[model samples]
Target: MPAPRMSTEQEIEALDEVCQRLAGFEDAISLEWLDGYLTAIVASPRRIERDEWLAKMGQGVFARAYADPADAEQAIKVIDSRFEVLANQLDPELILDDADVLRLAPLMIELSDDDKKQLVADGHIKEDELHLLEQTGEVWAIGFMDATHDFPNDWPDADLETEEGQLFDECMLRVVSLTMEPAELKEVFDELYDGEELTREELIHEALYAAQDMRLYWLDHAPKPPQRRVGELPGRNDPCPCGSGKKFKKCHGAQMQ
Candidate 1:
């Protein structure tokens, strides 16, 4: 049987423990960033292996490692559970529960009062600039963009020639805009939003809509297996009928013998 779904409170507690454990590592990503990164992996047109994405978790050349091996294993379990939840949410055939929709909501960067004051005092941002910072989803967008950046070959430029492709391109641009520096953001916003800044509510809505569009686009466009005649077995070297991109012999076919 499949694993039981985690309760909302349980999921929160597990993620909190993960964040606390990784807190001491300067290069480790925040929980919000991890959420976005995993969302991108789920929405990817091609399946990214768990180990491959896990290795890319750190900020620079170094990979994030837990001091205790047990902690690492436990953290991976939590992260993998979240990954499965995201993948299920994007499955086109599945009817989402209310809780699933709630889980789909993007995690945004929330600043403590002290963090706000520190930013203001350092002149990194004006006091007023901190308003609605929690709803902007900037860090989440950065993490999403990072995944796309790392796999440029996997995420090719959208075909502007078709309406659906054009819409997909627009959605991608909207998400990428959130990751821009002030000057870059202004340039993109001017073109995409008629030079008006998006409010926090608008940003949140746009990000959610973009993610939905991504799910739909991939469902329609991802590669499919060839049809087979009734009772005809798959060739040993053919792509697995399960759509895993592995040869038949290495996938489900291995179970037959």
Candidate 2:
């Protein structure tokens, strides 16, 4: 039997616990970043293997051995669950419902007063500018960019020639712009938004829309999984469905026998 599905609140609580446990590690990504990473994977043009993507997560933190094996296992389980949830939300075959749409939304990071104070101390922003910045979605954007960088070949500059491709490019740029410094972001805003300043909410809205568009684009453009007859197995000489170059008889079919 399949495992029980977790509610949105339950998932949030689970992710929060994992993040809290890893608080000492500066490089450990938060729930927001993980959400963006999983979103990119769901919308990717090619299917990424579970092991490969999990290793790529948090710069391979999830794949590393921990002092407490149970802690590592628990964290991995939460990450896996989140990935599964995202995959289901973006499944092309399903009609998007209200609940699915809500679940598909990105987990944006909101900066608290303490966080803003730290940013000022760290020289990331001015104390006066703290009031201007709300939830910037910077961390989530970085996570999305990381996933794209992993599979650079999948998103090519040549795509910019098409209308849909251009839109995709704009969307990606909008989200990535959140990662820029304030001065840099101002320049981008002038170029992309006709010198009109955007609020943090507007920027985050763009990021959310970009993610939705990416899912739609990949649903239409990505290679479809090969159709198979029900209850039929691959022929001994056929290419393995697992995507291995080896023939069936030389791969998983060999194990069956």
Q: Best lDDT goes to which candidate? A: 2
Sum up the clashes in candidate 1.
Answer: 0
Q: Assess each prediction's global lDDT (C-alpha) against the native.
A: 0.71, 0.72
Report the C-alpha lDDT of model 2 over 145-164, residue by residue, as the tens digit.
88877766655452677897
lDDT of 2 at 123: 100
Report, for all candidates in order, the number of backbone clashes. Answer: 0, 0
Pairs of colliding residues, candidate 2: none
Model 1: CA > 4 A from native: 1-7, 20-23, 26-28, 59-64, 95-103, 112-135, 181-190, 193-197, 223-257
